[model samples]
Target: MTKCRECGKILPQEQRIDICLDCSRKKIQKRFRDDPELKDVFKKTIEELRKPENVKKMAEDTYRIVNAINEMRDGR
Candidate 1:
């Protein structure tokens, strides 16, 4: 059986990642609660990413990266 890396809870077979969902949520919550600077930066980044132009750019960048990876794999 798979186990959570942080809490040692037995993970379901279908779960791929080492950390369980509960531990991931707790880690993110603790990080935001403990680090004000990171919290602010994360909030700002979220706001920026929510903008329409930024969203489009990010999508385009992701598409480009995927195509590049595909090309490299085909070339191999």
Candidate 2:
């Protein structure tokens, strides 16, 4: 067994996550289950972003969205 790096909780040997696993799962499941519009937006965005011609733009957009999400979480 080892300790989780983020929360400093004891975890089983097979569980190698750094952060709070249960908290991450709960937030992921809740977002996927409850955010229909966001899901559709992601689906469409993925399709558009997958094209070879869109690679640079996709990277830029990915960074922007990730930074925005991080900021939102930090604010909370």
Candidate 3:
């Protein structure tokens, strides 16, 4: 058995889906309706991380991006 990550609802193994089916469906619908660029960015990030030579660069870039995003969120 597994539990929903978001709601913490205990469910049987077959009944449990990643992040719970409801949360996953809502997330998918949200991705389709808004913030579609996030999907592309995630794919690009993964692709970059897969290359050995790009690992360090990707880590640094991710750090910078995360900091910038956090700063923006904090209204810095």
Pick the lDDT winner. 1
Give the per-residue lDDT digits (tens) of candidate 1, residues 1-68: 87887899997676555666567656545656754555665566557766887764443333343344
- lDDT assessment of candidate 3: 0.54
Which ranges of candidate 2 are over 4 A from the true structure? 1-36, 67-76
Compared with the true structure, model 2 gives a TM-score of 0.37
List pairs with backbone clashes in candidate 2: none
Please write out the lDDT profile of model 2 over residues 1-76, one tens digit for every residue. Answer: 6765546877655554443455444443455476454556555766887899976555345434444544655776
Write down the lDDT of every candidate, Cα atoms only. Answer: 0.58, 0.55, 0.54
Best by TM-score: 1
lDDT of 1 at 63: 34
Q: How accurate is candidate 1 locally (lDDT)?
A: 0.58
Error of 1 at 65 (Å): 19
